[model samples]
Target: MRALTGHPLRPVTEMSPQRVLLVNLACMGAPALLIIQGVLQHGKVDWFAAGLGCITLFALVALRMFDLVSQVHDKARQLDAVAHIDALTALPNRRAWDLELSRRIAAARRHGSPVVVAILDLDHFKKYNDEHGHQGGDNLLSSAAAAWRGQLRPEDLLARYGGEEFGAIFDQSKLADADRIIERLQAVNPLGQTFSAGAAQWNGSETAEELLARADVALYAAKAAGRNRVYVSSIR
Candidate 1:
């Protein structure tokens, strides 16, 4: 009755380990004080002796449970982080980009708005890697992706499209808008790090696959044009 009237102390079942340890220490220490007072006054030690063992057991159990829960939470967070990032470049990976692309494409198609697809392939990338070594190639790819991402709108979709290639999907964008973006991306990337890009605005005449193939042809044309430039499918 006295304990209930003072205030309701919350249960320790959900409390953190540090808090639980402090509370248990306080509880056990109080009993020791009471026992010392009782024994000194009347030669009795039952209160302290009885409560000490139970408090010790409870603290051990709480600490064990806290460690287990913390380990599990840490593992879950690591897995979630890995799911969205590319293993190679640590960029938001192809899987994450694909999901965003499908969503944007559906929205654009429904609203009768324009969307642009740009495919970029590094010019002479194999030769560059062969001459510079694998580590240099990895560094170049990482730098290129970062530069491209920096030039994109917050809503733009960018993904590494296999070896030495990348894909970008820009919704509600025109050819001129895509051209500006490509220029900015190229400008920030390293010198001699040139890419051929093919861009196409959605025309309702082609599936995504067909549209991408057309973009690839334009990319090849851009490469044939001496590289380091953007070409639209309409121009091709």
Candidate 2:
């Protein structure tokens, strides 16, 4: 029984919930038929046999309930991935960006580490999309995401903020260090495209929203001055 339990039933546990339920029904049916037959023949119930059957049925029901719970947990994980991931570029989406920014800011406050937030916008993306079809634009975005991600450190997080725009958090980096890294990103810009970026270092006393707003101000400044340049926010 120990050998059979270790080897034969191992595969059964991996079977689908429907198949296991059907197997359980079949096993229970045989015991039920026997119990009914004994009662009819002897004009008496088999208490010991009835007790064993009940135990078997209870165990099978518990297994089915556990399988259902596991399935629900898997589905929940899939939904979380969909909510936080960008379908196009395969990067973290804006919802994920906000969450990560807040988390990183909290960590920086606790550890007294520098953190930089940057926003990058492709120069003349609307015109690019107009010239090329949407498919081409999408390919460009995917390629650029891959390229930029390769240039950054593993700890740095780059996310898709919105259409043709990206957001990044540089962990333990000052504004100048982040600026240099963004320059590297620009150097490897895909498909002859260019981007403008704005970066702000955390000033020891600012909310995530305030830091992002400062970065956003610098981003617009880059766009206004001329496209294809990096601007560090003047806000200390």
Candidate 3:
């Protein structure tokens, strides 16, 4: 089970070896003492054997309970991953992106750090899907996500916001630096595909929604101008 789940059973049990030993001793100590007393007083092997059997039963039950708890923990982790991750591209989904954006905004407000948000939309994605099949489009999306993720810093987050759209958050980074990173991602797009992006720096007072809306506005502006360029939102 540990091999299949790729997680340790210890974390789910939440018990150290010392604690587990103490618990086992507590459960079996009385029976063991009774068996010893019976053996010493009456010299009966039957009494000792019965006590040993009971202790073995208790140990087996404890082991089963621990296994069940570990299974539950593993299943819960799997469910969480399915909820927050996009199945197609294997990237964080829109819900995860929203939560992360809010978290980054809160951290920036508290620490006076910089936050840059960008929205990128693949150019002519629907047309590409029409020309190639949906499966082809999916493969492209997955490939593009892998390529773009490789180009980003580990601290930066890039998520699949929705169909053919990705969201990025650059933490503790200047807007100019974030823009350059986005350009690098654009260059690495798979199959010679192009994407238009819009970026906005946090104003230190606006909500996450407002900041993203500004970037979305810039994205529309970029699409209107041309479909393969990056636009920076004007500071308000």
Best by lDDT: 2
- TM-score, one value per model: 0.65, 0.84, 0.80
Q: Each model's RMSD to truth, in Å?
A: 11.2, 7.1, 6.9
lDDT string for model 3 (106-138, tens) is 999999999999999999999999999999899
Q: Which stretches of candidate 1 lie over 4 Å from their true place?
A: 1-81
Candidate 3 has its poorest 10 consecutive residues by lDDT at: 1-10
Q: Kindly report which residue stretches of model 2 are placed more than 4 angstroms away from their true locations once superposed.
A: 1-44
Where is model 1 poorest over a 10-residue stretch in terms of lDDT?
A: 1-10
Name the candidate, 1 or 2, with the larger lDDT value. Answer: 2
Which of the two, 2 or 3, has more lDDT?
Answer: 2
Candidate 2 colliding pairs: none
Task: Please list the residue runs of candidate 3 whose C-alpha ends up more than 4 Å from where it truly belongs after superposition.
Answer: 1-47
The clash numbers for all candidates, in the given order, read 0, 0, 0
- Candidate 2 TM-score over all chains jointly: 0.84
What's the C-alpha lDDT at position 196 in model 2? 94
**Candidate 2 weakest ten by summed lDDT:** 1-10
- What lDDT tens digits, residue by residue, belong to model 2 across residues 127-232? 8899998998998899999999999998999999999999999999999889999999999999999999999999998999999999999999999998899999
lDDT of the candidates, in the order given: 0.77, 0.88, 0.87
